[model samples]
Target: MKKYSYQKCTAIVLAFIMFFSLFAGVNQAKAEAGLNVNADGAILVDGETGKVLYEKNADSPLGIASMTKMMSEYLLLDAVKHGKVKWNQEYSVSELVYKISQPTSLSNVPLRRDGKYNVRELYEAMAIYSANGATIALAEVIAGSETNFVKMMNEKAKKLGLKNTKFVNSTGLNNKDYHGEQPQGTGADEENVMSPRDVATLAFHLINEYPDVLKTASTPMKVFREGTTDRIVMKNWNWMLPSLVYGYKGMDGLKTGTTDFAGYCFTGTATRDGKRFITVVQNAKDSSGKNDGYKARFGETKKMLDYAFSNYTKEELVAKHYQVKGHKTIPVIKGKEDKVKIYTKSAINMVIPNNEKDNYKPVLVLDKKKVNKNGEVTAPIKKGEKLGYLTIEPKNGDKVSFLTEEGQKKVQVDIIAVQDVEKANWFVLMMRSIGNFFGDVGHGISSTVKGWF
Candidate 1:
């Protein structure tokens, strides 16, 4: 009996080891499923257009984590752009900044006792490292306090049309919102939340409108106090920094974030060939709470970019509403010249939504006479001027309108009547008494001569 008991106990122990081994492997695999590493939501979109190429739970409001800093960066850049702040200006870190840097929050720029730094250095530190303390310091530097800065953030959000996003704090640090401050705790007291679509839209404007902001965001590393012994150097947190695939050529830089409630989130832009694309992934489960599901984000972003480049194309759109190839000159009366030029004014282009070269047609909307009733074109129609319009319409009925593709200076059209040409009219000649009298005299003389002969 004792020998049988020992055999059974050994068999149970082996089974237990095998079970955990498989379980650990499964957990690790889930964390690396690049597609399944799991986010409450994810999205891939065209940076040029808001068209969603791939979306999973796109509209759901989830913790954006430090992707919130993008907004702060935008507002800060706005201050610089609008002449509210200068790039070279110096600002001393206040005590508030020192207090916020105690934790490992992102944007923890090492500002010492009344640490004085240039606005440029602070910006680099905050953007490159996602330094939470640096963010707070910069906010104070710009707005005098983090509270005022958060107010500015909300205003900027509304202007960007970010309806679903809320900004309660500047650094996106843990604070309580119930007492009118950023919240911290479980999911209940969270500070910021945004949809995948809003995040991409904001990024689109940043990449397209303000390339410099993207320029700064794409920095791989920043070296402060370069030659000094205590020089601080920070590396970009985005892992896609080095190992980019064929579809991921322009894997530049962006922001990454994590917290107890927010999990891991990333907002990045990559260029393949010549096309630029943006991807946002949020609330991804850390398979073992480790390297994050970067695998899923990379795979999906590449797929999205590939789908965009392969299936979509940039089609030259030409407005074809009212266009005149060879506008004719019309004679004028009592004008600078004898005639004026009358042409059509409209543009034509193809709205290529996909890779297919679809057929197109333009609807011409012009005056019957190709000129205004008063015989004028632009403000100063010399002799002949083009004042016609061509409305472009797709055969299927969907349409877009644009100004006529025409030269800035309009050709003059004839403003006065050509009375000499009017005399050539059959009615005018028939009504001439002098010509009738001469014709009668010639007829009488011919009758007399013929009768005498």
Candidate 2:
């Protein structure tokens, strides 16, 4: 009874101490994102792993403002790649673009009456300056109209596996132009809106599919000729481009957008020593008396980047010519052998933040039975193909465990097919000389008869 009493007293005291410490640990500055981050629907994701490094309100659907221009650029760029539009192609700004810009939406690049701009100029302007008019022009140049272009945007979003996103306009002005979460919701706006995850996925894909998009977006300054007038200097809205912090400034490009609902949002990225990434922040105070909104953004990003640099490291989780996570061997149909050791498609690596204990080892996981091997995917299997998974946490029954970073595609593991000599040795001689004698006679008789005829 005395031991139980003592134990209960100790537990009560410890609970009190923990409860107090919890509130004590709350940093007044870091706890609240503040006007610098009004209501962040943000994400700091590893560009390579598609893993969430940090998140705030990441799942909630919020206004995206001019960020929707990313989607417009995505489709327009697709059009250009597919020969639907030309960089030098000109599109006369339509009346609707002018009418749409009249709202209190983001409009750094308003169009003039009968004004014209090339597809490249519009893309540059929209990507760098979050120009509403330029985005509309680019979309029109590709889809011939905003409505049709928006449909394409939604379709593309669906294809990209963006489940919690929808597009209602070329430019991302959410209040009126973008609809709500559903197509037939009670109310929808004219712009586009999505979570941080979808945005990151879009950004990841853009960087992977069209790396040149980064080259254009990172333009600190561009002299663009528009509408037969003096060359307009399009300065980059992404403030990170001007300076590099800890060798990561080269990743200085992408998009930025702000509105009353969306607040201030910026997707900033940089690369150092081969590592590259993007940092996104949403719902922070804009330039409206907020000094330079860039400071808070860059500050947070620098911290994340610095942590990624000082602590985390990209190491090979799986190696080429090495066995996959679980499977001992892979069935090789029509190959030289009945089966071969299935190795990781590429050298799998991960950017693990430092401070993790040295004893950390990724646990191997394989359920090859579930994967549809699509007829022996040879060397150079595509990036997202199922290449066995690893467990980040060692198994402990039903306690739960995280999966390892997805396998990467780096080393070429082209499959080598070897002929089965056993199968070849059993060749039937076609009833001995039947082919030799009969084939020769058939050919000779046909030729001789043709000559006689």
Candidate 3:
């Protein structure tokens, strides 16, 4: 009996251990399945159309760190394009800028107190290395002072329709990092802030307006002041670049940022098999909510890219010359033909989900000035004349939002006349009117005769 009791106790102990182990395994799996994004704010968008494919807390404003440089990059590119600033124009280092460059803890290409670097070199440093000193120098060169440059950055942000963005300083650094020399208009503790959506919008404009910026942005490693004692190999912080350790195919030209307040953030763009997408991940972390260095940001970006490339395909949602059912044709007054056909001026192509291929419908809107109360247009209407526009919407009646307010209203094509309608001759019009008058009189006489009978 004693031996049997001891054996039973051992068996029970083994069973209890097995049960807990199984429960722990299930919990681990649940945690892993929660969310691949692992970020405070994130978004994925169609590179060509600015369609919002996916988003999570995307509109919430947060610290942007070095990503603020993208706005600076845009303004600098504009300045160069307009010949307002020359690429080779030299910039003399200021005392404030010199002090910022001396910090070993900050990312920088050190500059001498009397250094005079050209615009192109400084820009390369800022873009590739996120160099703080180089960015300040470029800002000073463009606007004569950092204080003035911050104003330009904010103004440009507003003009671009970036609703949730504010620029406190040219660099994205915490103002206190400036050692009591922060931009005059900003508080000493303030930092630049932007929403994930705003960041994507800014990126969209940057790529569209100044595509040449990508040429420099794609460089993985470049030497600042090459062939000189001051030369330093400025490697891009964007680990997702094709030439980097976490190299992803088709990855190119973008920016990355990190700070104690912002954590890890990345704005990445990639093209594969002619399909391009833009992804933004802000404040990325591990399952435990701890910063996982550069890996966390790029890992989240990869998940977004995979989802976009795998699920979406470019499709012609509306074919050219497609006509609406009830609105296929409109009546014409005093014309050789009594009616004219109208159709879409061009095909409407969009990047849409594979499962939703047939979920869109066309909505036609006519120009009020072109059509009278009877929905008729007078004679002499030319072929291909614009009557109005046709917009596409989801058949399921789900409201779709885009990255920008303008983008939300852009899914439309022009409606045009299919053929010309010439005015009818005056003699023919007069004869037709005379015949119609007699017919009405004859019908009235017939009605009176029937009543008498």
lDDT to native, each model: 0.61, 0.61, 0.89
Q: Model 1 misses residue 374 by how many Å?
A: 15
Model 3 poorest ten-residue lDDT run: 402-411
Could you give me the TM-score of model 3 versus the true structure?
0.87
Which candidate wins on lDDT? Answer: 3
Query: How many pairs of residues collide in model 3?
Result: 0
Better of 1 and 3 by lDDT: 3
What are the models' TM-scores?
0.63, 0.67, 0.87
In model 2, what lDDT does residue 62 have? Answer: 69
- Residues 248-321 of candidate 2: C-alpha lDDT, one tens digit per residue: 45566677777666666777677777676666766654345352455655555556566556555666644655
lDDT of 3 by residue, 249-292 (tens): 89886899888888899999998877789898889887688888
Error of 1 at 137 (Å): 1.0
RMSD of every candidate to native, in Å, equals 18.6, 14.0, 9.9
Candidate 3, residue 233: lDDT: 88
For the record, the alpha-carbon RMSD of candidate 1 to the native fold, in angstroms, is 18.6
